[model samples]
Target: MAKSKNFLLLISLLAFFPLCFSSKTIGGYLYPQFYDHSCPKAQEIVKSIVAKAVAKEARMAASLLRLHFHDCFVKGCDASVLLDGSGSIITEKISNPNRNSARGFEVLDEIKDALEKECPHTVSCADILTLAARHSTVLTGGPSWEVPLGRRDSRGASLSGSNNDIPAPNNTFETILTKFKRQGLNIVDLVALSGSHTIGNARCTSFRQRLYNQTGNGRPDYTIDQSFAAQLRRRCPRSGGDQNLFFLDFVSPTKFDNSYFKNLLAYKGLLNSDQVLLTKNQQAMELVKQYAENQELFFVQFAKSMIKMGNISPLTGSRGEIRKNCRKINS
Candidate 1:
């Protein structure tokens, strides 16, 4: 009888203690159990769809991961990135960082359709993106964490925020750090979150400036590995092939691991922003070395930073609506 009473007290503590579960609120409460009773199969459905998509195309995992990042950085993980231009909304898909990039919207539509069939407006598109991102990491050989759900869909999209807020591949280290800080992320979060590049692809256009004229000079950036630069140039060229695909990490590109940090130590990081983590600041450089030396540390920090990033200014309580369709606002 005494043990039963203690168990009930422990349960009560968990029910009230947000930090114990890492479900602290910013603008509103978002907890992992938000849909446990309402839509018990919500997470299962997201994982199954994300796994199928990733199995179909290994790159799909990376694309879905990026979708969550792009969404959160702009209007706080509200699924505003999913909105198509209609009425007063301006589409973010055409933004510089997203144009010809940011694939996997059709995959999201399929997930939403499945959820609607099962639960019918019980889950938010924002939650779907967040859950899909965590699943993507796991499917791609990365760590998993409990996603705090209950985020809502935005009624409008931000084209300017998408363009200005998302850091470019060639952005200076300070510029990238500044952009992350604007989103309430710190230096550690910036370095850890940037590790998402471990499993993605980048366009030739995104890093071409370094290959040809890094500082308006005729030579390639000396910071890059010579043989690697030659290989990149064979496909990238000086002009054209802007849409050509290149792995962000040449070694283990599709697997989320410490290879990205190792590539930086070797001066083979695919993007200027990547290498700058080593060159630009002493602290970030130490972080790169630490992650390169310890995959477990990177995984832990990456999960924590992802949770922090997902918590940015969420619309909860009564602010936004859970759209029946992810792409349009409800009338």
Candidate 2:
């Protein structure tokens, strides 16, 4: 009898472990076990699809991760970024920050489809996006954390909010920090979240100004190494190749690591938004140096900051609906 009681107690404790990381929102709590009963295989389905996608195209990991960031920044991870324009809806996909960029939608659709078939109207697209981001990070050799689930998809997309809210590559450090602050993130979150650049690519157009005319002075930005600038200019050029791709972290570009911070220290950061983390603010510079020196510390903070960012203004309880199609609200 004693042995049986002890075994049951241990099982109960194990089952309750995920609830420890639950995040509280205005409507209700979001716990990791949100679908343990309703959709027992929800996370497994998402992870499998994300793994297949990332295995096929390593860049897909970063693109999926970026989708979560872009989604949360605009409307709090409500899948607003996934919506297409129809009637009253205006797609955020065509916004300045996302147009010609922001990929991995088909991968998301694949995950959502599998999820819907497994459990109809049970898992939310918002939750799928959140899980995909976490899976993508882990797939690219980054840390993982328990993502609180139970989020719902928004009924509409925000084009204006998408354009103005998402940080632009050319924005000054202050502007970027302010944008993050508006999302309830802080300086530490800014530096840590920016570390996501460790595993992504940037367009030539995103940083051409720094290579050719950083301040419209018709001269290269001296902040960048002359040799590196010359190499970038060859591909980026003064006129065309706007869509040319460059690794955000030239060293270990496909791996999620602190090399991005080290690149910033060496002035090799691919985007102006990236280099400014070190040059434009003393505090952010210190963070860059710390992360460059300590990969473990960067990983720990990256996981925490990601969870914090994921918790921004989620729709819970009776707030939002679980959309049948990720691209449109339920009719």
Candidate 3:
């Protein structure tokens, strides 16, 4: 009788322990598990993908992971950034400075190839993004924490979802702030992540307001460098469309570091929103100073931000569908 009671108690504990088991079966499929630590294989695959892409030149597939977290955290990581008009992939036009992870399928292919070969289809693309971000951030001198693996991929993607959730480069600080806040991120994290924008470019469409709308746009006043603005004005010529996405931090387009914050302090911030850090959120400004001073501090916080962004209300346990074609998964 004693032995049976002990066995029953063990079973009860397993059944009731939500933290231990709940994460095991995320959204019912089972993922976000720790299959690999500092996954060397995963890093290699990320390197190969970054190596081949001109769009992602000097970039990391891990950025795609960051993007996946960005999008998903906003409203679930659907790989929406990877979607096309039809919800598949915009294979022709992918990953710009703003849409860093736009290399969607290409990066996914690389990670998938490696995982499939070494470990088979044991890991999902969803988790791939999760881990890749963690890995890449570490390489870029950010945090190197262990992410729970086993996050299953959503078989869905579409232009609408991408257009809907992802924050644009030139949106008002209020808009983007709300978006970040919705994900449980504070202003400091928002400023740091937006600082990533300091490294990327914006379409004429994304930045038109700054150039034309100007004052009271609610953007961080004079966010981009004046030289950059002049150059944009010359190229775009107020006619629009020609103002392509360029690197805000021309130094190292792909790496994540304090250069963004450094640029902002120098009035070299890219988007109006990027510039907004100074006046719109002074606390965020101080953090920029801190991150600029210490690399480890940035990494630790960035990882936590990434994690907060990843485990959002995913379409797990039947809440959302596994998108077949990321672009048109819903329609």
Candidate 4:
């Protein structure tokens, strides 16, 4: 009778509860979701900031812009990625301090000078990072994901909070899928936006797996292609490795085109997460083909993916503060 009663209770609980309420698994990895009710005006002000930054440091605007997008995409536009990953690390997972690039701070200062002049404290540097991310995509010759504005700055950046938030770059397809689904994004978006990897730079420490892993020796059921495999292995070799290897185009590293996907199709994608696109699903395979052949297809999907990615871990409705500098929160 007790067993029967317990079974009934278990069923009742499962039936009555919402799935998300079941656990914080999805959330512990996403950025806060803040509603940007005031995104348009904020976007315009941000656009002006980009223009100013471009006027001063034309060569670097695209990179700074990419920085913000990268942060938002990884853990929503929470600006947490702008910090020390908020200390978001998975068990046995390596931490990537991509945001810690001094290059990011260098461009951020230029943007601060511009925003302070036009909007002053009226605009938060957090919003500036979000807007700058969108503009940077456009500047990079990719589609602009429409950014909703007015995300107030986070009051406290818990390196602890961040540590549990961002996804691991070296994760498996299942791991990446679970992480993305938590943020309301799906596998298709994951594979598509990951094509952005085609143009970015990374340290071998981030992607040494595909290089040193056993399957990459060119076996069936191996994650990626051999030529691409050999290339990454060469960079982060069992022998002494070189750090300047770009994950983007072996042909044209800086151009934001389909080469990343093209490389993945060839098994040349730099990261293990990247090679998973080919093995993740037949649908992802189709996307790789479409994106490689049709630039517009890649653009449209990338824009949608960016918007979805940004919505993760947001700071909606008085959740966070608007800081004077993006690097640090306002007291």
Kindly give the stretch of ten consecutive residues in candidate 4 with the minimal lDDT sum: 26-35
Question: How would you encode candidate 2's per-residue C-alpha lDDT over 1-331 as one tens digit per residue?
Answer: 5564354334434433443345566678677889999999999999999999999999999999999999999978899999989998999999999999999999989988998899999999999999999999989988777777889989989999999999999998999999999988899999999999999899998998998766666665767877888899889988999999999988998999899999899998888899899888999999999999998778777877777787788898899899989999999
Clashes of 4: 22
* Overall local distance difference test of candidate 1: 0.87
Top candidate by lDDT: 2
Residue-by-residue lDDT tens digits, candidate 4, 146-238: 354445555444343334444555766788777677777787787776777655566666666656664444544366666666756655776
Q: Would you give me the overall lDDT of model 2?
A: 0.88
By TM-score, how accurate is candidate 4?
0.72
Candidate number with the higher lDDT (1 or 2): 2
Candidate 1 weakest ten by summed lDDT? 11-20
Candidates in order: C-alpha RMSD to true structure: 5.4, 5.6, 9.4, 11.9
lDDT of 3 by residue, 169-218 (tens): 66666887777777666676686566544233445655566666455645
Q: Candidate 3: where is the Cα deviation over 4 Å?
A: 1-33, 36-56, 60-66, 80-101, 158-160, 212-228, 231-234, 240-243, 251-254, 315-331
Candidate 4: RMSD to truth: 11.9
Model 2 backbone overlap count: 1
**CA-lDDT, candidates in order:** 0.87, 0.88, 0.55, 0.58
Clashing pairs in 1: none
Better of 2 and 4 by TM-score: 2
**Cα distance off (Å), candidate 4, residue 16:** 33
Backbone Cα, N, C clashes tallied per candidate: 0, 1, 31, 22
- TM-score-based ranking, best first? 2, 1, 4, 3
Model 2 residue 55 distance off true place after TM-score fit, in angstroms: 0.7
